[model samples]
Target: MVKSKPVMHKAGHLFSFVLGVIFVIGGFLATYLKGLPLIEQGKASKNWPTTKGVVLKSKVASHRSSNSNSSTYSAEITYRYQVEGQNYKCGTVWFGSDVSTSNRSLAQDTVKKYPVDKQVVVYYDPQKPAAAVLEPGVFKTTYFYYVFGWLFMGPGILMTGIPLFRWLVRVGRGTDERGENVAGKF
Candidate 1:
């Protein structure tokens, strides 16, 4: 009787799973660690300020859906200011709302709180005026990305690692079911 070799499907799965895990972990770490630094850099840059400004313009726009169940809103603002001995016009877009009613309400509230042509303080990067952000508390929009990234990453690592660990343990028992020795199972 001819014997078919045991394909290492699990091994491939493990590799892909581990890769996903690494991506999640790395993303979380990058977000967490870099958040503060980015904030600080915004503060230190000459171009950016945390002071009040008269909003030149404000409008609501839509962005690509983050998911099938949700939609997103973008609040664009144009503030006039001068940098490096030249007149400049800066505009920033704040994301608000999702498909959820609660998120939509939150976005509406933010809009109401900070209306068009209203005076407000915005945090912006000096190098890029287009890359500006509002102070965190003004809108109360939850840092969803940070939350989502960490949430998946923690479990992804475990989901990928545990199986690989179990496979290692099985291989360590010195049984070969695939013609290759146990030591070469991985």
Candidate 2:
């Protein structure tokens, strides 16, 4: 039983380290994904080449949830553009990319800006010509990613830092002439 206690103690420390690493990685990944929209938009504005595209299709798709009997709507916009005699079809119509909402009117309003056959400007990534967006801004969802990222990261740092800090405190206190653990005497 005594031996098992030490094993359990070691297991606890290992668990804390592994859990902290997982949370930190997830936090960073979420933050990175949140920033992708802004990065793509910024890149498009500065150096991405643009071409005229014809709106092949534009509509609001309302997807109903069977569980809650609720619906979420998204503006579905598909356009085709040609670059250097090569044609490409892109479905990314908004800066936020397929901006969706629970409010049907919001989706409908977005679709109006790009009716079928309407001519509009399309921005394409120079390196990957197929990647494009009609809009170049982020949505409210972007902030959610950032918020969740920090929520995970805060505890992650605490989990990792607290152990290291406690170890340092113990090591520092051990140098005292008493040669006794402070908490142990108490």
Each model's Cα RMSD: 6.1, 5.3
- How many residue pairs clash in model 2? 1
Candidate 1 lDDT by residue in tens digits, 53-95: 5667665555555566656665555666544555456654332
Q: Give candidate 1's error at residue 130 in angstroms.
A: 6.9
- Candidate 1 residues lying further than 4 Å off, grouped into runs, are 1-52, 63-70, 83-102, 122-142, 167-186
Instruction: Compute the lDDT for candidate 1.
Output: 0.55
TM-score of 1: 0.54
Q: Taking the tens digit of each residue's C-alpha lDDT, what string does model 2 give over 1-186?
A: 256876888789989978998888888776677655454464455457789999999989988878877888988889999888899999886555454568898778878989999998988887778887776545564355667777887888888888777777777876332356665554
- What TM-score does structure 2 among the candidates reach? 0.68
